[model samples]
Target: MARTRCDRTPAWAQLQLAYDNSGKAFDLRQAFAQDAGRFEAFSQSAPYVFADLSKNRIDAATDKLLFDLARQSGLQEHRDAMFAGEKINHTEGREVWHVLLRTPPESSQDGSHRSVELAKVHETLNAMLAFAESVRSDSGITDVVNIGIGGSDLGPQMAVIALDAFATTGKRLHFVSNVDGHELAATLKTVKADSTLFLIASKTFTTIETMTNARSAKAWFEAQGGTDTARHFAALTTNVAAANAFGITTTFGFWDWVGGRYSLWSAIGLPLAIAIGAQGFREFLAGAHAMDEHFRTAPLEQNLPVRLGLLDLWYRNFHGFTSRSIAPYHSALRRLPAYLQQLEMESNGKRVDAEGAALPFGTSPVLWGEPGTNGQHAYFQMLHQGTDVVPLEFVAVKKPRHALASHHTLLLANVLAQAQALMVGKVDAGGHKHFPGNRPSTFLLLDDLTPASLGALIALQEHRVFVSGSLWGINSFDQWGVELGKVLAKDVEARLGSGDTTGLDGSTAGLLARLRA
Candidate 1:
């Protein structure tokens, strides 16, 4: 039972056969014109998500071969290994269990594997939620500022703004991630020192940018005659001793199994909890938990994450497509592209396997895009006529969160039109007007972008990452890549302060001189 890559599988040969014989290229126009059931056959509904993959260049035989590839690749074994709490992240000897962070206490059957971890997950979650509720109800707390970088800053900040309409609490939320003094200065100008609460978010309480920003924020607060330091600042770091030494009384800890990119379900989601309150936050977790169960138990052919990941492998390995575009139609979900950029690129952007052997194949693709209509104006032209074949992923909501009906209709129309246009291209008589007709795209429709739906959507992405990582045989959880730069930056920062560039790279020395000047 040696694990196999998709290319080594027998199904890969079948896929190649189908791909070769399926004409010069599988044309979506021809497929739709020939089969009346094209849309119905390609579209699928699972939980809160519905995907319309009809616009893609794939055919019936393509899907069959892809499913066979999934079976032959041992995708099920890799998936189950993760769910069983095996050390799938072999590079760090850690279990990849961000999924467990969202699993509800009641849903875990009495003797299930998840039930064993349920007690600790809920214990921290409950304490964190209680703290969030307390902050929400506090009339003295007019503003909450979160100091973090990467996953710590992105997920909570994005969700809080996305769910602003659902926020009953009137408190304003601010996130400071940059080392630049201007960001903190601008934020501090708007809030009274006595009325603001700052959440210092770093897993180790030692991330240079986070700690620097936290210290600057504290300095500003103290200089402004703020008396109560303990009440005003809390921490979301596992390093309780560091937080205590810094004079913070409250702290929340997450397990090592939770990677920074996948930490939103852990205490990193404290800002979301503060924004939406305890009940809404719990609904978010429950939604993710439901998707976790679905991912863990669903058959490969029927599984949404599995299907999507298999498609990813097909595109990357077989078709040689390099990047995939994510277009979320709703304006509220604008940050989703950025959030996923970190989640996918940071997780699976590895050149080595879990055993640290250099891989012969590609890992994660470069994920970059803005919200729809916006991207339609910006990059859709390149996608329509660009030399490279970039697969598009469109996320559309069935219902609008906003009250503006006209805007929603126009948005939906643009979304539908884009996918339609991608499949059915226009060819004019003139040479410049000849549009290519075989570009591919995937459409994901959500019932709505409620906390529950968003949770499910994000969880689906997490599992998709898992599938791709498993197939690549890489440790997706540990981010050793992010560390080297941090280490280098410290040396550079000291050189910048002291005008010393002894024994540095040519580029580093030159950059140092320019900065010093």
Candidate 2:
């Protein structure tokens, strides 16, 4: 599919005019008062997620123009290209086939003609799951530590923690992602070498932070008289030779089609597989696959991802909102904010379009948040009455995994009330008690936070990001921004060891000297 930047479209100009005419003064309160069916008109129900977008500053006219913008930008064709196995990740020359990882083996038989890739996907999946089950059944290994960074860490860590109720009862999962020694050190203090199984996760088995942690773990294992290297250690990487050399006889591989940000469905999810076991892991994948099908077949008007993505673009380009706050109400979903931060920021944080041309407008907004109620006390103040207008996305679960009805009811009440309060502020005689109404928020409700629901929810987020990026003309699959830091860090590390600040800038040189001293 040929790339078309959104700003270059006629719909973009029309949308701008549309915004100028009535979009700027879009009052959520007035819209509700004027339209009796405003809530039902904007709300949508998908496989496992329900979204209420009536609270957002948008209406029927805005929706039509936004859908027009999506059409003008060739979003439909672009989405088709993705599912058709074309290399939409133009720069990387790889297909964005994370969907394949989630698809069941039987799906290949349905005239999809993805049998070859599907076979490979299931091969690795079966092997990885067998290994995970074996590890889970082993009573000796009580702890599993995953050493990886970025997608390697965030996706698996977040999913495992989110689905902790389904995790192996006897085992504890630990994630070490930070390059700082403190994180790994603290994790090491909790587990002995004999009882812990270390999983090294890196596509090349050569990420500096991952390898550094891997080596430290190996050193600790050897020092503690642990000898079963092959049984105790595993690698999630394509570099078989390097993993073999590292004493990892068990290794699972994935293709370049899996970008780091979108790799949770791949072998990088081994930790998640281990935690949830093979059946639960399959359910997770099945949920994501359902969402993939929805994104593939649903009409633009009814598509959840399309609607959310269009709203994101509308807020960023027209409404001039700079950030979107995510408030997942469940404590089990605490890592969701961080997971989305990397997912959205790393995927679409681009200055240049797919054709390597500079973009005239902003792409991804600053996505930030904490779990609800906790944030209500912290940054909720700024969100409620701050000078800048920031949009909020609230994710709530209708059914609780726990039996605490009182706690769950209170939690749900707080989330609903917060959304209501954001839109309907109170006017008081005292300045401190007064609140200006008409703030915008989006509420996403799930029946439960089961593996399937969480997977669908995350897939919903991933596709929405893809929609916005595709329209914006950015390669949502590639991340060149993260490369510079690694290269510079190598130079700085050499300088640190050698005490050579000769060519260093003033601040770096001073910091190096202080560190040495």
Top candidate when judged by TM-score against the true structure: 2
Q: Residue by residue across 1-517, what tens digits does model 1's lDDT show? A: 2467655779977877776787237788888999999999888877789988778777777888888777777878888787778877777888888878886677545876667677888999999999999999899999999999999999998788778878899999999999888998899999999999999999999998999999999998999999788999999998999999988999999988888888999999999999998999998988888888888888776788988887887788767788999998888888999999998999889998766778888889999899988998899988888788899999998887668659989998999988888778888888577678688899999988888888889999999988887777777787888889889888887889998889988998998899778
- Pick by lDDT: which candidate is best? 2
lDDT of 2 at 190: 96
lDDT of 2 by residue, 96-161 (tens): 989989987874355455778888899999999998999989999999999999999999999998
Lowest-sum lDDT 10-residue window in model 1: 1-10
Tell me the spans in candidate 2 whose CA falls farther than 4 Å from its real position.
Answer: 107-113
Q: What is the alpha-carbon lDDT for the whole of candidate 2?
A: 0.92
Worst 10 residues of 2 by lDDT: 106-115
Runs off by more than 4 Å, candidate 1 = 106-116
TM-score of each: 0.96, 0.98
